[model samples]
Target: MVKPATAADGRWDADPLLGLVAGCYVAAAVAPPVVFAGDAGLSLAAGGLYGLLLGTVLAVTAVVWVAVARARSLVVRLGRSRARWLLAVAPVGYALGGFALLGQTGIAGVLAFFAGLGAALLGIALAAMAHTRYVAATVDEASVEWDGRTGWPERARRRWRRGAWVVIGVTAVGFAVGVLTDRWWLRVAAQALFAGGVGFAQTGQERRYVCTEAGVEQRLPVARRLFGWATFDGYTRTDEAFVLHRPWRTDLRFAVADIDDPEVLADVLRRHLD
Candidate 1:
């Protein structure tokens, strides 16, 4: 279990699981580049051997880094922002996907395929575990002011309803066309559109939210998000909700009516924003 952030310094306990996940991410990120470098080095007489040796050293370094308590602490500190932590791992996914494509058509292809699949599955598991642990720790340790469920604003819900219909229509048409034309890519696109339509259809569903001194926790239908005070620059109040603004990311909207004490929530936000 992860430890909550201490009130004194606001630092969380360095959980070993966090360190292990970080180390695995580091290894995944290093592997593809190292393999490419080794391939490139084959042109030189001894460059391939050198590249292999360098890769081994880096791999060992990642393992040792995970073993150190201070290093784990640093990783835990950095991962405090769940959004940032997840974003950091995105490149690993891209790298693994690219490697899988590059090595297609041989034993190398099979290895890359399994590697990518395993990494993706492992990443999901690690993220879920870390998020659960941190949220539990936060709730246990922090002063929670309000905890309840909220729905999207009526206006937003209406917009999503319209959008969902359009998406579903397009998906149906696309699928029909793909079937007639026998195009695999078009079928894939239609499937993606259908998935998106499902998301749009769920827009007005009620979601749980927790307001605490540390941050706001949003438990949406598909995922749980913890938005720490540090993640947002400021917020704007609407008739129905308070919108937390962040740079280059979607803003978080908390329904004011759904919260029991608006003034207390406002004060809590003010203390953090100020």
Candidate 2:
């Protein structure tokens, strides 16, 4: 059983199975290397694909079971927003169809897989652009005299450059692997994994974040998100990051050096939380 991550407050995180959900995709990406680390890697990429499928199955099964268990209370608990949430099923449906189509042979399969990969990244960039384009966005992120581009400009800039470099390097390596490998599936896997790496790097770029009376608003280049104080139960510091522990299993985090006026930011963050 997947255990829920505990906040300092000792409450269960709302999503107990987020790791499993994420692992489904992660498994898909790493299964190849796990099974066929050697030169003899063309077993239909059988290990990679089967592991992916298994993770998908487990994730879906877990989600379905949880949904069913809570079905009776969903509408009343979720209220009028239930319909809006249900509409999210459309994307899940598309995900299922998209993956099924990827298994096809010939040009159709290639197009479906790569197109889907590109579309996801494109969608994020477009969505982020929409926040600033459509929403009247402002920020108190730089509230401290030492905040924003002026103080942390170099830090954020370096991070952005690093993210770009990682994606470029991964893409180059994927291309070389695709050419040298005898298996077509290997090529597809390499590209897909590298594409995911690109997405990860893109996400690492510091979003335009603002602290407000209600909470925090993140205006990322690829997406926008608002997180109320209630969304986070506590804060935790690790060697690498300062984390806002969310109700969900995952925490939102920032590097200590990435944001300007670290001490001031920490104070503001603590003050805002309920």
Candidate 3:
């Protein structure tokens, strides 16, 4: 559950401006795409009209976004902001599924697929920023303690790290096979394998933190593990980043790099300590 920040808690990951932009995205996704193909016949003029209509809709969406951001609470505002991106991503999935069902495979299909992919990627980037703000605000630096108990699940997770390397090794083999075979299906499978391998490799690193934060917790596999918990003191807010802090914790900064609501995290830490 996310912790709620009181008025006293420092604002973290709060982006009223971004929230407005995100709201516009949500509106755009919900609105109908301009329809140029009709009984009147599709022409350059019709296409131009379609574009003009779409642009107008987008402009209206922007206005609505601003209104919504101004009206909602910070947490609600952030949630709506993220929802906008998620809404934007839905179209990509729809396009992919539709094209696959239509048996459309070729340069055109690939181009269309990639176009959707690009939009999806952009949405993901926005969502990631929102997520960072959310986590930073909700998870306090102090709450993440290194007591001494190593639970069974944690041990199991640690043991699973061994499999991560194996997965990576297998992925490499698949990639080689796919390239040699020159089969389209094989190529896709190989890429999937490689991606999965990378995922597992990262998971293996995460396991390092699973070793209960007891005395001398295990260090990350290498010095370059970038996603470890930072002391609250290390966190800072920027115009681009979500900033959260608590007035009571003067010694620590407890800022999360890219959360949507740092206030929630601060509140969580505060309650846990109290």
Candidate 4:
């Protein structure tokens, strides 16, 4: 679960001013394509009415994007197959309504838009739901012994060192792409990748994780988190991931390679939860 933060401190992932501008930018980007691609019968000659309609469309887009961006989960988990199907129905409903209203230029274009839109909205809604349902059981956060300041586990240290170099190489490729394509966005993405690589490298060199009897304390450039057995509803270990299940939401994921000692960690978790 995400730790709650107040707006007073500069702890937000996104800057408010920039986020607002980004929302508006997204609104503008999305509306024109839809309106221009629509039927010939749709008129924009009435200046006042057209402006009002366009504004409304922009407003809706901004709201949806901002809401989804601020939403809790990046993906959704409905817990069961049948429930998932039920979630899909809402998007289908959106498509139907869109078809009824915007299908003037034949069913094809309308169907494409509505279908894509419905799917996107459904995914966003599910993620939001997962975020909402996510919870961490109560535990003694204070008095938690943390040896993280010493160093990362030896295995994790090696992995982090390797991963950082790989990421930096990727960032270089991204930089090259941006230069070749003359795309600012590409450069921005490259910058983000570089920053992440730096963070990873620093994590390896800095104080490591806090491993305790209760759970593991994960430290990042952004925040410190403790995931304890007291909250473990279930767990699934796979080749790629170590998933810890708590209540309500889907499983929490950690890279399998990132763990200190997988066998020992698994045993401790099993013992405590049992």
Q: What 10-residue stretch in candidate 3 is worst by lDDT?
A: 207-216
Worst 10 residues of 4 by lDDT: 72-81
TM-score-wise, the better of 1 and 4 is: 1
Q: Using TM-score as the measure, name the better of candidate 3 and candidate 4.
A: 3
lDDT of 2 by residue, 148-249 (tens): 321123455467658767876877777787788766665666776777666655544455566665466665554445565777888876555567788745
* Every model's TM-score: 0.56, 0.40, 0.42, 0.34
Please give the ranking of all candidate structures by lDDT, highest first, separated by commas.
1, 4, 2, 3
Writing each residue's lDDT as its tens digit, candidate 4 over 81-171 gives: 2353444345544544555666454433454345545464444444333322332221235634434243444565687679898999999
- Model 2, residue 93: C-alpha shift (Å): 9.2
lDDT tens string, model 1, 19-106? 5565565565455445554555544335664566456546754574446334433334434555644633565556456655664433
TM-score (C-alpha) between model 1 and the true structure = 0.56
Question: What is the C-alpha local distance difference test score of each model?
Answer: 0.63, 0.48, 0.44, 0.52
Worst 10 residues of 1 by lDDT: 4-13
lDDT of 3 at 28: 38
lDDT tens readout by residue for model 3, 71-112: 334533453343746644675774475357444333334433
* Order of candidate numbers by TM-score, starting with the best: 1, 3, 2, 4
Winner by TM-score: 1
On lDDT, the stronger of 2 and 4 is 4
Error (Å) of candidate 1 at residue 219 is: 3.5
